[model samples]
Every structure is written in structure tokens, then in C-alpha cells.
Target: MNKYLMTIKNKQYIRFFLIPTILCLILAISVVFVLLNQRKGELVDLENRSQLQTSLLSEKIAGKLNSLELVLSMINQSARSMDLDNETDRERLISLVKSQLYLQDDLEGLCILSPDGSKIYSSFHIITENLLENQQRMITTHTRQDISFSLFSFIDNKAWHLVLSRSLFDQSGDLVAIVGLLIETHSFFDLLSVTEIPGLERAILFDTAGKTIATWNQKDALGKETIHLEENIHLIPSFSDSNILNTQDQTINAGIKTVRFENSLLTTVKLGNFPLSLGMETFIDKAMASYDNALVISMSVLFLFIIISLTVITLLGKQVIEQEQVQQVMMDELSEKVKSRTAELEKLSTLDSLTGLINRRKINSLLAEQIDNRSKEPTFCCIMIIDIDHFKLVNDNFGHQTGDEVLIHIVRVLQQSLGPLGTLSRWGGDELLVLLPSHSAQQALDIAKDLLVHIRDNPFSPDIMSTISIGIAQYREGELSSDLISRADTALYEAKGSGRNRVILG
Candidate 1:
């Protein structure tokens, strides 16, 4: 209720009459504002969800590629484990891969051929039927240092596989037989079942050359664009794509915008990296369905509340003065109390009683929030944990007052060195946590070292040259807030461990 109504202490019945109407207005405004805010929030949430899913699919594709590489690695390991190049070890080497993953039958052949392309060891067992066609292809495609891959099609059998061949070298780098690993593409597709997000409905993977390799389709998909077509997002027209291979993996999620044949409606495209640029594209209709009932209920409730208010206001015209006045006064008092309490809580939460620097809790909260929010343009950031070396000994020898003054002096120097762009916090009894937002770890260390030098350089009131040790660390993307602090802590311990008056970074 507004303040004007409260000053009118008379009109008891009138006060009662106006109260309901004022409450109804407050409620109506609040509902509208909340609904609008929620709708905005919903849009941001959807975008994040879609992008995150796309990134995940990309990671899945990269993972499959890695798996292929691992299979090749295993084959190479087989040749080395048995010394395949030595004629005496030929039988054992031939049986190596066959025993692994229980694939003696699935593995068509294993042979050790000489550099001149003549058979040295043959597990295929056909005496007269020479391997000229495949052998010549392999020899031409690979040298002693070269690796090759080929798709093998069996006309009389029902199996799908591609073979990767790697030449083995000795410790002195001598040419050995080409090791082969048969990869079942079906198994790679089967591994795609691990993720559980819906409308993650479908994904198509493209090789580095943009050739379609595989896809995972939802049960309801039309399955045409998803069918082994060329791996071009432009060619498909239903999905959008993204890349995620730098050092680590990432995912992207997009929705099927439109079946251009159906309509050219804009679609959501999720793209990611694992080894391929895979994406999930779906119609916006799924999102619409999720929002439908909540939106309708919200509007319906708003309308119903407005009608009820109107009916009550008609029945009791001006009988709402006292109620409105009382509520208005209470709200003002509550608001003031809340404002004062918030400040008190902030002080209690952040400030150290002795040093007046931020406390551990506030420093930790700031560090976590900053890491999460400041990934893209981490202009500069560093952490420093400072401990008064032999602080307990100082308290025992001199006094707790002198120890407290040392802590205060430490913070004072930090404030002078760091200025406003940095933060200082009391981490524990004799330690201060410092954060320099626009500085590197080295920069922070320089500042810390300078402080130590100043302490040693300047003699205090009673001619004491007090000292402090510091730990420092820089930040990296996706790294937890703990990473820097842990490094700093270790560094601080090192500063103490190796002898005091130095800055160390783990």
C-alpha cells in the first residue's frame, strides 16, 4: 500500500474498503513482472540447453575417432609385444590380435610379409591362393614409415569393417610387418546410446573431409536426411554445426529447423566435436510444448485474481483505510530493517575483526563466481595466500598485539600495492588471501616479493625486520576456483618450507 492512505487515521470502514483493492494492484503488477521475467529466463535457458547438447554430441564423435585410433594402437602393440619381425616369433605374433577381443574368426587373416612383398608368416592358411590384389594395394599405399586404412567389402559374407594398418619399427627403427585392426563401425554407432538428453534426438557425424561417416537417429525421425548422406550441414539443411577440438572436447545441440520440403522455418542446430562435427536439430515445437501449460496457467490465475479483486472492491467501496495504513507502515519498517540487516550480514560475512580485510568465506565466494563468469576474457587474474612466518612464535615471544599489528601491516602494504583492482582477505589466524584481478601470477608474486623486501628493508618501531611468505597462482579456463588456491597454498607452504621471505607458485 502507498503511504498517503496510512496518514488518514480516521474512516475506519473506508480503510477496510480500500485495502483489498490496493493488495490486488500490488499482486497484479507482481504477477505480470514475474511472468515476463520467467519468459525471458526461459529463452536464455533454452539457448544454453541447446548449445550444451550440441557440444556433447561433438565430443561423442571425437570419442569415436579416438576409439578408432585406440584400436590401431592395440594392433601396433601386438606386433611389438611378440617381436613380429623375427621369424622365430612369427607364430605368436600372428595369433596375438586374434586372441584379443575374442575375434579369431572375425579376423580374416594375419600375415608377416617381407619388405619385397613376399609372405614371411601366413595365418590365413591358403597355400596356393596368393594375396596379390590386396597385397599390391597395401604395398603401394604404405612405406616402412607410412600407415594406411581401407574399407573391406565381402561380397559373400554379411560383415561391415574397415582395416587400419600400421608398420611396426624396432627400438633402432627397422621396418616390421604392417599391423592391422578391423573396426566394426556398428560398434561405434552403438556407443552413441550413452547420452540421455531428449531432442538430442538425432546426430550426424562427418569426417575431417566432411564425408558422412555415421549417424544416430531418434525413433520418430524421418531417417532420410540422416541416412548415410554426405556430411555437409548445408546439404542436409536441417541441422547447424560447431567445432570443439582444441585440447579438450565440447558439445553443441541444435534442433531440426525445418524439413525444407515441409517449410523453410528457421531451425535450432546443435553442433559439437569428438572427431566429427555432429549436430542435433529439431523443431521448436518440443520447447513450445514444455512451456504451454505453465504459460496458460499463469495467465489464467492472473485473470482470476483480477476478477476476484474487482468483485470485492465493488462490495466494499472505501472500507479499506485502516488495513492499508497498517500494511503500509509495516512494509516501510520492514524495508528499513531488511536494509540494515543486509549490511550487518555483509560485514559479518566478509570482514576480519583484526585486519578489516575480506574474510575467507567472501574471498572464496568471489573466486568461485569469478571463475564461472569470467572465462572468455580473463583479462588478468591471480591469487596470493600470505602467511606470517613464525607467526605463533612471534605471539609467544612479543605479544598477540604485536602479532595482530603485523597482520594489519601486511594488509596495509597489500592495499598500497594492489590498490582497488585487487582484493585482500584474511584466510586464517596469520594468513591473508589476496586476489589481483587484472594481473598475472608473476605480477602478484612481484608485488608479494616487494612487500617482503620492504619489510626487511624498513626497520619497525623497535628495530624489528618482520617477514612474510606468499604463494601465487594464475587461472585457466574451465579450471575450478580451487586450482589456483591449491597452487597458492602449496606455494605458500613451499615459501615456508624452503625458508621464509619469498613468493612460491606451485
Candidate 2:
């Protein structure tokens, strides 16, 4: 039963990749669907708002026109009753205009102008008798636009007002005077104050020149293009008919725009007849914030799922391979038997019989891995070639066995000295190599000096104490492993030529 269970475990069929991946894919697709749906819904909302803005802009502007209509009514009424050439008729026209404005509060003052821009009447009794006679010196001279309603600045600069003008005529069709009323623009912008999708959206009114007449935010823009392509509400098309009802969303540019028009101007409004158009936009930050949050959550779940799946696969693979248990069992059985058999091989592959340090073959492989994996951290390292000082004399004087003993003891010392900072290897018979990982030339010099001091100070064996010569060179980019090793080796030759037992800086 146990064997059968192990066989079943080795089958490696327990994983759920087909399902989990499909499910992950499905979940990812669902997230994309959710994102797309949310975006679509928001866009639909934006489209609806744009439509309503177009309509409401007409209505809001129509409401704005309501004040102008009242002023036009004043102009039309004044011309109906009076024969303006007579003094009685002229005074009657002035009194009639003032009386009509008596109930209207937005009217700062009303005025009648001749074609030559002379004020025929003033609503304020404070008007001087000759104020009309002095054309240039009177109040402020405003350029006249015929038959249109506009918001204009008042003289005291205390407030803004909507001005309406129309061609006034007698019943017999004789031309008389121009009547205009100043309606406070503040009230017109106030009606448009509204909020949608929390504080993410805003509404605005643009004039015939694409200049914003009013906005929910206080924009000091009377002439600046609100419908400029890279500007304010962002490139509303020129009005084709009296109304513009559709638009496209554009990608963002780097520069951020400020909201210029203000008042309490925002509200969802119904459709009506008006010349001005309305536009509402969602703040990119607010709209994309929800999408970003969803993506982050989805990515987190995806990464967690991937990690768990990989871990499960690895564990399952280990169970199937059974390599560790097999190897451990083999090693345990051979532990005693192989010990005495390899006696002549005290060489133990590449171990210096004198020292237990690694051979050059292992160092070569280690260097290959280090250099290849160094993409993660591309930096310099130092290579040092170490050789014993006057080794022929040491061996000849002390006999080969004692000499061998000295080499072994020195290898042991080098291995212990490097610790984990470097890879210590027996380069050839008496030569050694030390690769100090991520170490600079100066650091390598210090290390070489330290090692030399330790060797000269420590007793080599019962009979002798000795020191080593080291030549250190820093590794550079594009240098082959062999070339780097050769450089250090050359430095070592230089050290030997210089004297014995000194570190030659390369």
C-alpha cells in the first residue's frame, strides 16, 4: 500500500495548472472586463453629461437671456409710446425705461444711446444734465455690438452686468434710440452650479469665440479659449448649428489647465432654447483612480497565485525525483568502503595534498558563474595570484616531506584567512589564485598585506614559519577570465622579481 501510494505521488498529476491557469486567465479577463465595463459606464455617463450640458447650456444661457429679454422688453416698450424728437416725448421715454427697471434688481442702471454712441437717458437720477453731451468724458465708453446679449463690466467696477441692445423704432417706423439693460452675470453663472460623480465632474459655458463665459471654478477668463484643443474643457468644436451635442475624449497632455470661471455654477439641467453651449468633464485623476486600484488588486492576486503555484510544482517535482533520499542512501552505504580505496588519491581530485584548498578547475567554473550572473550588479572585482617565496630552497633544505607539510599548512592558512570574502584555489603545483568578489584594487592590497602579515607571524608547522608573495590586479570590463588571471600571474612574477614575501600591487 505504501509503495502504491508512493507510485501515485510520483505520477505528478496532482497539479491544477489547466484549471488554475484557465481560472487565472478567466479572472484576468474578468478584471479586464470589469475595467472596460467601468470605463464604458463612465464614458457613457460622460456622453450623457455632454448631451445634457449641450442642452443645459442652452437653458442656462436661456436663463441668462431671460434677464436680457427683460431689458429688450424695456427697449421695445420705450420706443412704442414716445415721439422722441419732442422734449415731452424724450422725458417720457426716459421715465418709461426707469419705471420698467423699478422691479428688476439685476439692472445696475439702464441707458438709451443714439447711433453715434450718445446716452439719451440714464436710469440713475445721479446722471449729470450734460453727461450725454460729452461723449468721450461720460462714464466709460463701451464698444457697441448690435442685437446681441452680453455680460459687461459696470463703471464702479463693483459688479458685472449683462447688457442687451436692440434697434428701437416708432410705430410709423422712424428710428429712435438704443435701449440696453445691465443684468448681473453672477446670477447667470450661479444657476449652473452642480456636481456629478462626487466632485469629479464640472460644467462650463463657452462663448461664440470658444472663450469661456462662465465656469464652476472661478476662471478669470473672458477672452481665453475654453474650447482650445489643448486648453480648458479641451477642444469643443465650433458650433455648426445653434447647438453642439457630441464629442470625443482626448488623451492628456503634460501641461495641466486651471479652471477659470466661477460662481455656484453647476447643476443637471433639462433641454431648452439658448445660444450658449455647456460641457462637463470628469477629472482624469478621479476617473483613473478606480481603474488603478482594481489593477493593483488584480496584480497582487496574480502574483500570489503564481508564487503558490510555482512552490506547489517545486514540491511535487521533488517528491517525484526522489534524488535526495536516493543520494543520501548511496552515500551512507559507501561512506566507509570508499575511504581506504582512494588512499593513493589523497590528491582527492584537485585538493593540494599540502593544503585542502579547491583546484583551478573548480575556480574556473566558479568564475564562469560569477561573471555570467554579474548582470545583476555590474561592478569590478580583484584577482590576486599568490605564490610561495623561494619554494625550491624550502623543499631542498628541509627535505620534500617537510616542504610538502609547509605547502599544506600554508594552503590551510590561506583558506581560513579568505573566509567567505574570496574564492581560494590552488592554481598549479605551487601557485594559488584568490578571487576577491566585489573588491577594489585598494581593498585587495589591504587584504594581501593582512594575509602576508598573518603568514609571516604564524608558525608554519612545529619546525618552520614562512610568508607568501601576492600580486593583486583588479578585474576590468571586457577582459577574459584567462587574461585577468594572467594579469595577476604577471604581477606575481613581478613580486618574485622584486624580492620574496612582499605583496606587489597591480
Candidate 3:
């Protein structure tokens, strides 16, 4: 009877343990298989999305280029009918170009170049030599039947401009002149901005040689200035080789491809019939975030099932709950510390350490904001650049400590005199920049005069005398922040040059 009881006990134990073990193994395998299929589907969806976006963007670019080409052809026809040497003909051409520029906001300027690349007529006065060289190269490389595209810029700034050139031929079929259209890259940037989709981190436009022409980041699109091509040339992917771009078959060149680069999955599509390609990139983690979360949940469920099957569910669950609670507490503490540190850092970054005033970078951002607002709604705004006259002499005669004290004292006097009229920033050593919004040139001038008087009265020390020169500039319609600041700085130099301790309006 005892032997029979032992056998029954052993059979019950196997029934309780072995059956559930087998079932759990089967369930885990099924879960993994389903997850694999799901992951594959997700990847395919991502690929399809990327391909569709790339094709749409390519078509948009091609459409814009076609429109530009039509305009260039119209201009070429007009050029062929006139004689560029005659003064009346030149005036007529200029008038036509100016009218076109006024009509098309995307057109930056227009120019007619001789066969040798000398400018015969230009709508704008400032032309870079690089434009001439590019035109000349186009004239030399392509036949009269071909229309060419190249990049150029103005002499004053580093902004990139795209040029579409078509050659003009006389009845003899010899190249007579080249008609070029200058295109604003900002329009292209705007297009990119409009077409941006979720999960897209960056979109870059590059030429056949892998030189970046333009780049747009989703995060920086609104606040930051457009990136200079020369500065971001190295950002082009290394896999963008001639083998990919120089394929003999045209269909292959039109096809889009996906490749991996660093931590990103890059989708690249060549622009239609142009020596340019657009690349859209997204980080791998961002692209797979949903899939990763689903996988983790599925794995955790399988783990819980296994634990329950082992008959230690209640104790293990309680332990897990305790561990999770502890983890949450630790995370909360860490988050609080990080928030405190970040706040401290942000404050330190924007303010000057010594005088507790706004720093140059913060002031520049504020000025830009004001300029943008002015563009939207016309307003009166002025900026003043104040320089402590003969400051270097103070450091030389007295000590650096006394010079610092003088700077601090002057800041206090200016703050007291201005009295909420303007924002004061420490531009650099012994130099301050004040932004006065809703103030006209005359109001700004009066404020500057008051500041000068206050500085003259306030001495750094009993023995040390300090004075400041003020230069003021009012914002003009459609003017940039840098240009406004430049005028103020110029006025400041003039005030110092004429005589110290004076106010000048720019």
C-alpha cells in the first residue's frame, strides 16, 4: 500500500510540473515567431514610407527646376532678339530683368554674361568672381544646346545661391552669350520645411561630387539660420559615391535606396535629371521605438508565465514590486537633481558672471527676435553700443581689479539712468550693448545723452575717473539684426574718433 502511494505521488508531481513546462516552451516559441513577423512588417512599413516621401520630395524639386528652366528659356529668347552693345538695348534688358525679379520672389537676381564670362548686364551691383568663373566653366564644358546648373554666391555673405544657365547662339550656331538666373536657396529650405514628416531628423541636398548644397534639421529649422554649405560639406554620407550617382542606366539613377550610416538609417533619392540628390535620415532608435517597446512587453509576459509555472509566483511578485518601487524612488531623486543642475547651468549660460547682466549670445538672440517682430509688424526700435573710453589705459595705469570695478560702476549708472527703457548686455570687455524697443532715433539719442552724463558723474574710485561714449542706431524696415548692430558699432567708432565722452546717432 505504501509503494502504491509513492507511485501515485510521483505521477501527480510530473502532471503538475512537466505539463506546464511543455506548454510554456510552446507559448514562448509562438510569441517569438509572431514578434519576428511583426518586426518584419514594421521595417517594411518604414521603408515604404521613406520611399514615398523621397519620391514626393524629388518631384517637388524637379517641378521647381522645370519652372526655373522655362523662365530661363523665356529670358534667353528675349536676349537673342536684342543687341547687348547698344545702350538702349542694354537698358531694355535691365528693365526686363528687374520686372522679372519683382514678379518672382524666388529669383534673387539676373545677369547676362558674355561668352568669355564677363558680365554685360546685371540686376544687382554686387557680383562675386565665383559666379563669373562658374558661368565661364559652363560655357566651356557644355554645347549651345545644353542648359547647365551651378552654385554661386554674392561677395558680401556666405549664403549659397543656385544658378541655372542657358547659352545663346547667333544664326551661325556659335555661343554668343549666356543667360543666368540666380535662385534663392531659402525657397528650397522652405520646401523642405513644409514637406517634413515625423521621425525625419535631417534632410540634406548635395551635388554629384558629394558637396552639400543645403541642409535642414527638424529641430533647428525654425530658430537657427540656414546652414552655410561650406561649413557642412563633410556631413554628406561617405557611401554616396560616384558608382551610385554615375550609373549608366537612367532608371537606376532615379530609383531610391536605403543604407545604414552610423546610428542612422539613410534614404537617398536622386533629383530628376539634376546633378543633385536629397538624403533623409532618422536615428535607428527613433525609427524602431515602437517595435522595441512591443518586444519588451511580449518578453516580460513570457517571463511572468514562466515564473508562475514554477509555483513561486506570490513571493517573486512581491519582491519584484518592492524592487520596482525602490527603482522609482531612485529615479525621482535623480530627476530632481538633474532639473536643479540644468536650471543652474541655463542661468549661468545667459548671464555675465561679473556684472550679472545679459551676455553677448543672449543679447543677440533678443535682438534677432525684435528684428523678426519688426518685419512682421513695423515698430520703432533702437540699439546703442556703449564703450568705456580709454579703458585699456585704466588697466595699464591702475590695475585690472580697478578696471573691473570701473566696468561694474558704469553698468550701475547706465542701469539707473536707463530705468527700464532698454535691456543692457555686456557685449565684451568694457563694452555694453543696450536694446531699446518702442523707441525712436530721437528717444534713443536722448537716452544715450542721459547715460553719458550719468557715467561722467559716477567715478569708479575717488582717484579714478571713467567716461563712456554712446553710439545709437534705429532699426530700418526689412533690416537684419547684424546690419543694425553693425551700424551701431560704426557709430560708436565715429564717436570715439571724433572725441571721447560723446553721443552719435547712426
Candidate 4:
């Protein structure tokens, strides 16, 4: 009878303890499998988003390059018209070059290199020797008929600038001079900031040789210093593979690619037809934070289920089923919330927070779209820039709250006046841009005059009356959006210079 009791006890232990333990192990493995799959999905989503970001960045870079090339082409035409040998004509050419720098804020300086590679005229009083040498090298090796890009350092390597050079030819088809446009590397930093990603660790623009041209590191705070790497050092070590860095391989250079590192992920893309590449790095741990939290919760739930199974096996089985159902519901809810929040963020990104008007970035996209459409089918379009005269005084004499009220008041007046005419956007502080598609210059001018009257008539406060200055420009055929805006901006400057509360046409 004692032996039979012992046998029964062993059988009970095997059924209750050993079987449940084995089941717990299997459950843990299943949970891990689900979490791993979830983590993989997250990575795929990240890559898709990163690719979109890189493509947007490339477009911006290409737009900037196009603008620069346009400026160079304009300068070349102007220079070709003037006689460089004559002192008076040469002075006029110099003035023209200086005016270009003033019109385009991105241009560091403009210089005309003689056939012998010596600087004939420069906007700067002193042209550095290294800059001249770099331009000379570009001109010597450049065989392309279009604009050529090269990187050069100046001021004892304290400053780096991207040089855009275009060769000028006389009517005889002989090389006359090379017009060079210098752009500071920091200008490219704005591109990175405008398209900043949440988990971005570093954003870099590199030449074909893997030399860093411009870089933005997450460690640097606002207005801190920008990092500049040495000429020989490669800022991004992961791109050391010859195949990856090969510019001639159109297959690799066609689109953005994801490169996984030990601790991070890299998204790299080549600037279209340019010898430069852009790379954005994001931290893997930060990106997987949600996955990590979910894993922890799952493991805790599994442990709790194991404890319950030891106590009450049947109850534990029911609890496991119920918990899984609850988890699935929670996950569904989480996904919905994420999708809703993402949509909201995208909408908010395109509008101004204060005035609820379309923001500068959104307006730019609209203008670009109009330009594209115009290329396919010709049409008239005009852009107007409006500035609040003495806007700073409102904030100085009154408080910021009152200033806010004034801006809102102005936006309301403009909206009422601009019903169904065009799209109005808040270009920047105390400034706004109006896009009038299918409107001629005179029509835009008339609209600007009407807007001036409306603002003058409606006062934000009895004590505070706001006035505006308007600049109008009609888009020309084959003109760039930046050039059109620049013309309008120049007209605005003229309007402000002559008198506030007036209209000027560019």
C-alpha cells in the first residue's frame, strides 16, 4: 500500500508541475516570436519613412542647385554682353556680380576668373589664393557644358565653401572666363534642419571622395558650433565600400538604400547627377523603444500566467486566452491612435500655428506645382509679398500679446479681402506671400492696392493702426520659383525704401 501511494504522488507531480513548466516555456517562445515579428514590422516602417525623408531632401538640394545654376547662367550672359577688356565695362560687370550676391542670399560671393585662372573681379575686397587655385583646377578639368561643382576651403581652412563654376565662351567658341559662385557649407545645414527626422543621430553631405562637406550632429544644440572634419578623414566610415561609393554605378546611385550598422541604421542617397551624397543616421535603440516596452509587458504577463498555472491550471488556461484577446484589442487601439496622430501631425506641419494660414513650406510646394503645370501649359501667375510696416514697434510699444492680436487681425482682414482670388500664406515674421494664379502683373498690382486700403481702413486697435507694403512680380516663361520670389522680394525692398504703405512692381 506504501509503494502504491508513492507512485501516485510521482504521477501527480509529473502532471501538475512538469507539464505546466514545459507549457510555460512554449508560451514564452511564442510570445518572443510575436514580438520579433512586430519588431521587424517596425523596422520596415522606419525604412519607408526614411526613404521618403531622403527623397524630399534630395529634391530640396536639387532645387537649390537649379537656382544656383540659373544665377550662374544669368551672370554668364550679362558678362558676355560687356567687354571685359574695357575698364568701364569691367566695372559694370563687377557691379552686376555684386548685385547677384545681394539678390540671392545663399551666394557667399561671386567672382569672375580670367582665362589664365586669375581673379579679374570679385565681390569681396580680398580674394584668397586657395579659392583662386580651386577655381583654376575646376576650370582646367571641367569638360562639361553645364555648371560644375567643387568643394574648396578658404581662410586657412577655417571656412569651407562649395564652388559652382561655369565656363564662358566668346562668339568664336573660345573659352573667355569662368564665373564662380561660392556658397558656405552652413547653408546646407538648413536643409537638414528643415527635413529633420525624430531619431536622426547625424546628417552629413559628403563628396564623392567621402569627405564631409556639411554635417549636423544631434549632440550640437541650437547655434552651437558645426563639426568640420579633416580633409583626409572620412566622416562616415560605413560607406567605405568601393562599390557603395562608386558614383559611376547608376544602379547603386539610383535611389536611397538602407545600411544597417551594429548600433544604428543608415539611409544614404546620391544627389541627382551631382558628385555628392547625403547620409542620415538614426539610433536603433531609440527607434525600437516601443518594441522594447511591448516585450517587457509580454514577459511580465507570461510570468504571471506561469505562477497562476501552478496554483490553478484550469483557471490559468482561461486567463491566458482572455489576456491574449485583451492584448490584441490594446494593440489594435494603439495602431489606430498612432495613425490618427500621424495624420494630425502632417496637417499641422503645413499650416501656421498662429494665424492658421498656410506656412512658407506649404506655399513653396504650391508655387512649385504651379510652375510645373505652367511648363506643361503656359499661363499667367503673379506672387505678391506683403510686409507689416513698423511691426516691431507694435511689439515694443505694446506687449507680445497685443502683437499677436495685430497679426491675427491682419490675417483676418487679408482673408476677407482675398476670398476666392488666390492662396495667402504666412511667409515669415511680419511678412506674408500671396499666390495669384492666372493673374497678370497689372491685376496683381490692383489687388495689392486694394489690400493696402483694406489694412489701412481696418485697425487692430483704435490706438494701433497697421499699414502694409506690397511687392508684386509676374512670373516669366522658363523662370525659377526662387527667381520669381527674389524679384518680388526686391520690389518689396524698393517699396519699403521709397516709403512704407505703397506698392512696387518687380
Query: Of the candidates shown, which would achieve the greatest lDDT relative to the real structure?
Result: 4
Model 2, span 1-506: residue lDDT tens: 34644554444334433455566667767777886787767655644554454454446566656755766766676677778878998887777777767967556667877656666876755553332332322222223323222233222234333345555777886556666665555565465444234233445554333344445543533333333412333323333222121111111121112332322112222223333345454444344566667767877887687678766866666665566456555765687458766753654765654566778877887787777666678876888998988777888889898888888878778777878889898888778889888888998998898889878877676567676889888877877888887888888889888887888866
Q: Which stretches of candidate 3 lie over 4 Å from their true place?
A: 1-13, 124-159, 218-252, 260-263, 312-506
Please give, for residues 356-436, the per-residue lDDT of candidate 4 as tens digits: 999999999999999999989898999999999999999999989999899999999999999999999999999999999
| Per-residue lDDT over 1-506 for candidate 3, one digit per residue giving the tens place of the 0 to 100 score | 34544554455445555666677788888889999888878777876787778778878877787777777667767767777667897777778777777877788777777776677777766656776665566566444425343433332255666777667665456566777788766467667655655567777776655566656665644443433334433443433333122222212256787765555556778777666777776565667887788799989988787877666644554455556556666776799899999998998999999999999999999999998888788789999999999999999998898788888888988899988999999999888999999999999998899888888787877788888888899998877889999999999999999988999999
| Candidate 4: residue pairs that collide | none
lDDT score, candidate 3: 0.74
lDDT of 4: 0.76
lDDT tens readout by residue for model 1, 439-477: 876777778777787666653456445788888888876
lDDT of 3 at 346: 92
Worst 10 residues of 2 by lDDT: 243-252
Model 3 has how many clashing residue pairs? Answer: 0
TM-score of each: 0.37, 0.44, 0.50, 0.53
Model 1 CA deviation exceeding 4 Å by range: 1-323, 457-460
Question: Stretches of candidate 2 above 4 Å error?
Answer: 1-23, 123-162, 195-202, 218-275, 287-295, 298-506
How well does candidate 1 match the true structure in TM-score terms?
A: 0.37
Order candidates by lDDT, high to low. Answer: 4, 3, 2, 1
